[model samples]
Target chain A: MPQTKTQVLKIDKLSKDFGYRQVLKGVDMDLAAGELTLLLGKNGAGKSTLMKIISGLVLPSGGKISFKGQDTKKNPQNLRKSLGMISHQTMFYGDLTAEENLLFFSKLKKVSSPREKIEGALHRTGLRKFAQIPVKTFSSGMNKRLNIAKLMVMDPELLLLDEPYTGLDYDSIEFFNDYLAEFKKKGGTVLLITHQIDISFELCDKIAIMQNGVAASHMKTASYTYDDLIEEYQKR
Target chain B: MLNKILGIASIISIALVGYLVFFWAPIESSMGIVQKIMYIHVPSIWLTFLALFIAFLCSIGYLWKRAEIYDVVALCMVEIGVIFCGITLITGSIWAKPTWNTYWTWDARLTTTLILFLIFVGYLLLRKFMDYGEQQARFAAVVGIIGFLDVPLIHQSVTWWRTLHQPSTVFSTKKNVIDTPLLVMLLLSLLAFSFLLAFIASKRIELELKSRKFQKQIANLPQDHH
Candidate 1:
């Protein structure tokens, strides 16, 4: 079956300057609907900054970002409603239980039928047993699961993940891989930043390497092997 | 540019006020030299009202608009209001020590002002300890709005109850409540402090906004990773 994918997000000449230092110079990329894109970059390549801008956390100094054919600056509320971000920070109250955290975030996200949605997310993430326990008691892997549950509850069309595989264990990574596969099968789009090259190549439909604050190269996963991707990252 | 103009105006007016207060204003027969403190004290309290009112308005704007600029302005105004409120308390107590024979009193006006000060001080402390972002801004805005309840109470406290504090003179309807020279000087002092408020507020807001971005920049600074 041959079908053209719709372009959901368009980035053109994106630039970010943190005072004197220029972080993102002129990055351009397009993300199609129902495709998982892995953004690979080194420590200071502005991968996190780009993610932050797309997620509406940080304002870009220059350039344009369009989501669903609408200028993101002109329609920020719509953009926020259409996307969810998972960053290194927990972004949750530690004192709140897993269920409590979801309920609180659900209201913030203005989700319909919050209780039912939260219940399903907890069970799906395999954290139903610890639903009543405070999030501070959860380990790093559990926190990652909670973040995934948050995305499920948000039910956004796009997901922006920053260094999601930084500290995950084998089991957590496996769970994440399975969940991502299921999500992609259901037509969800994701822009993720990760250094886990092997799993990323297997999961991502396309790969982008950001170097010196620009999308240096973007290629299809089927067109490039794992070693080629690693070389691209190191060379950049 | 407006802030700079305000800064110069404040300095010039305050210097003029110093000259007039010491040389031209009448010497009270009863309070004598200590009564001179009223020039600074009254204006401090008046400027406190103005600063806190601005904070309250900005707080409402923040909650309604959910804009970061509103939050920044509200935070700066609250900080300025706290400083003036502290001055009011200290000067009022200093003047009261000789007149009322006590450095502290439980009068409604004094107590209300103190409560307002503490609330805003607590507001600053909350921001200091809490995480920075939308959540912190929302919480601060709520506190700023609720803490403003004491402003009106402080205004009517003297009228609502019999207290050692004097009744409203500047906004009062009573005739001959104050001499023309003293009234003119007090009004001029108020103008000076208002300009000062504008100047400080602009600077604080600028600093706060830049410091926040700088903090984020430092946190995101790149380390060597291949």
Candidate 2:
């Protein structure tokens, strides 16, 4: 009984170009509420560009992006307040402690009771023990964990993650999956970009495969086999 | 409420000092009636430099903390400094016509004032070149701090290298030449100028915030057509 057209995000005729190179051309897609959508592509695919456009970090050359029935182009700041993004680069201040970093962004987002939220985020991320240590002192996997904690503090309506499992160990990946499962259970929409097909199959309810600056295919998780996707990606 | 009250107080004090400068303070025997210009001129120059210094400090703070509000304050101070420096040049020219027998001179103070004017012009130009938001602020903050370093050197150049300009007498404790009435007028002008700087700076800060929001809107326009 899911409403297919109850779109949380709608992108139409999106195109982006850099000089002579076209990165995204006439890409169209839709995302629904409470659905975890996995974006699949090789290294040169325009997945990151599409996410940047959605997050208000980069302006598209041409297109319309609407979120929650409002035009993202008209209300980027308000959209940004509701959208949480975690990329490969941990966006926290290196000189500040984990708790301090969360506290600062929380205030920037104008979240009330920031200190209490910081403590809650730290506890959820299992970094409560290292909360006082500077982020620069943490290992790569630990830093990513803190990044997740930062996103959790905001409680965003839409979460965009670019390669969130890049440097994690097997145990950390399991921990991340558990957190994501809980996040989806709470009705938070997630758009994840990753090269790993197994993770996509295990986590996503819907999948979009991009190639040559456009979405090559969009299908339900059950419609395509893992080998079929790998073959389709290899052919392009 | 406080700023409004302060603005009114400054206006009243400036009026009283203007009366004192024209009537109560005695004209100097050497420089004649034109010497009275210093009662307003010197204090404006001093306050301008003081405002510039505050701007430099605020710029440093903005860069270090990456706060948008600090950049607003720095921009305000730079604008106020430019206004005062303009006044300094005009009043100095007026004073020079009767005292030095020329409307303009390449004296150290005059040269330094010109340089200070250019520095603020560059600061404003730098802001124009930037696309706005955090990068513009960081660039402006760095330039503001570096530009204000010249202010102290400019003030000292008259005394430091034996220039044709007279050294500071009001600030020097060893041989101050200002009389009591003239001193009171100068002090009152100083307070009045400071209040004016504060009032204008606050207004400019509001404008900067508005401009930032407008720029964001303009940048987002291309993406709405699809």
Candidate 3:
């Protein structure tokens, strides 16, 4: 028997350069539907730049990126609706209440019944009581949860997260893991970028190691033990 | 190379205009050499408006296309426009000292221009304070569009209200108010300053592109020593 999965994203020979220095050099990756792929890299491995290009926030200097069988360069706006991103910076407005932030994004995304979606996202993220409070007053953990709430309201087919659990506490981390599992169960695709391998080891279905502007290797988590992955990283 | 050629052309034409204004363009019957500042003042004001108009157009393009190149051009033009606006105010003040007997006045034309300058100053400050990316570009483009609405208002202020600043000479219905030599010099000054604006804009845009590349390189540098 063989496992076959639908490919949600296809990145071929993707390369990005900044002046004399090249960040991504002919990198190729494929993310399948309902799969959580952890992209592991050391600092400055060009993970964030790759995610930015995928989300249409940045353009690649060379190569191609196709999402859902459509070239990103040709149909960026159409592709944007299907992709949600959580990066190092919070995309919410600090002066606006948590509910207001969600409402604003929902309208931009043209979600149906925005009011209902806002309430539902807040309740699910466990921020119902703090819905009316300004985002500036929220704790780091609370803000991270609100970012997840943003993803829920949009209900994107693909989610790209860059260092999603950087400042989260134990409880928040647990909550995030549970949310990601549920999201995958609903047939969503995820490409999580992180330098910390231990944190996302169990949650990821596959591991792709990025080195020298390329994915050096990709392996299934089931086939490789924790120590085996570490040894592999060292070899690279 | 184009920028360099434009820069040289600007210098030559500006020097030619200066010689024509001081020697060839005859002094007015009433005002003497003080009227000469008009050669510098009017052209600076015209070029300022031109730069701002380009910025407005580029801003619109940036919003519609969401391209980084358009945003870079808009930012460059806005910065150049502000510099020209500053030159206009200072030169106008110098001309006013002997002609109007005061370096400063609260006349409608002067006041509206000042307000316009202040608005653009705020625009530049907004760009400076925000982080660079799509959000910054979006916000700046919106501000650029709104701030440009003041240009027409500034142009029409002298007509809408009775001001000590004289009404349009070249654009007025009156026939040949300015002498032929003065008109030639003014037009040449306009051409020279416009060239200068283009040259500066291209240079600034080059710097902007380089700085963006540098920033990314710095970001990719290793953070932890260990």
Candidate 4:
């Protein structure tokens, strides 16, 4: 029998407004430990806004965001150490080589003697050969892989990815998929935002569709067929 | 709308101040017509300092509050401050050629001012090259706050070191070095330049805000094809 996992994050009645525009309206979701959830939405549906709020990059207009049983607002600095983010933009320093960038972030995360961890992450990303190369010289696909490597080295409990597959080669995407599989096996939680639902639906355990700043529909990945999701998505 | 009103007001005041400087204010007995350039030169430098100070404050506000509005305001101030500082340097160079017999000097005031200008220029370059959003904003804010350390040093340079540049006449505790009419004209010019700074900064900030919104709209557009 399958076991239910503990809740790792709970977002309650989250609301965010940018000036006169309301981006998130009463968004409520619970992310369970070890479950990979795909957030699907049309354009301007506030999916990125929800991710930003979860990562503490943007503050919500009203609501509570609790991470690891504590309010994130109460101790953001401490909470930040346990969270890693990946987006279209690379957070690594272009001036630094891949190894150096990994070392720097690992040190910031207070990882003990990070050299071995850095090597392991680089090896996992299949970037060990290019570890000495400057990140600015890397291609877009390489940068995306390095971003995942950086997150791996940090070993965050929760990973928030926005369009994680935007500019990856098939081989790179396969590599990331394997990593995600192992990550979920180890009880790590992931909340991913992507428009490429056809490919992502395979790995996702749950699906949440956002429409006009709220969760319009949510279902288990096994319960809904790919056509069912596409039908539900179109109805929104 | 406010920017337009401020822009027209500034243009009128600037023209009026120019007329007063050349024709109404009594010419200096020592330097003649060349000394009149002081009216424009001093005010530009003053406005430059004012803009940077405001930028410094806004940067701090951004870091504390994590508000994008503060970041936009801080960026506008830095851009305007750099332009006005450039004017100060050029006008000062022209004045130096006639008064000090050279176009350049290693004087403390000039050296410190140049360094301040270069630092802000670096700030702008960072903004241009770095990826936009929260990460860029955080790094820029830290640099902005630290770069302001040079401000106090620049302000005190002339008094701290022997230099060809004259000590501030308007700001000095010493009895007014400039004539009564010249001082009046200088005050008027300062007012005009302050208005000009306000007008330009507001316009630039408005443009920045619009560009940001446009980028957001583009980002939100459906990428189903991807």
2 versus 3: better DockQ goes to? 3
Spell out the clash pairs found in candidate 4. none
Task: For residue A46, give model 4's deviation from the true position in Å.
Answer: 10
**Candidate 1's residue-wise lDDT over A145-166, tens digit each?**
8998998898888889887876
Tell me how far the alpha carbon of residue A183 in candidate 4 is from the true structure, in angstroms, after superposition.
10
Estimate every model's Cα lDDT from 0 to 1: 0.83, 0.80, 0.83, 0.84
The candidate with the higher TM-score, 1 or 2, is: 1
How do all the candidates rank in terms of DockQ, highest first? 3, 1, 4, 2
- Shares of reference contacts reproduced by the candidates, in order, are 0.00, 0.00, 0.00, 0.00
Q: Candidate 3 overall Cα lDDT vs. reference?
A: 0.83
lDDT of 3 by residue, B1-226 (tens): 9989988988898788778778788886666878788888888888888888999999999989877889899989888888888988999889778867789876556666787788889888998898766667888999999989766776676556643455644234323467787788789888888888888888999999999878877866854535
TM-score of chain B of each: 0.87, 0.84, 0.88, 0.90
Q: Write the per-residue lDDT of candidate 3 for residues A185-231, one digit (tens) a residue.
A: 88889999877778788878777888778873364746678788789
Task: Give the number of the best model, judged by DockQ.
Answer: 3
lDDT by residue for model 4 (B67-146), tens:
88999999999999899889989998999898778887766667677888999999999988986766677788898999
User: Per-residue lDDT for A85-110 in model 2, tens only?
Assistant: 88978888899999999988888899
- Give the i-RMS of model 2 in Å: 9.5
**Of models 3 and 4, which has the larger DockQ?**
3
What TM-score describes the B chain of model 3? 0.88
Candidate 4 per-residue lDDT over residues A107-168, each given as its tens digit = 87899869988899889888999999989999888899999998888888898999989889
Q: Pairing residues by index, what is the TM-score of model 2?
A: 0.53
What TM-score, over all chains together, does every model reach?
A: 0.67, 0.53, 0.70, 0.64
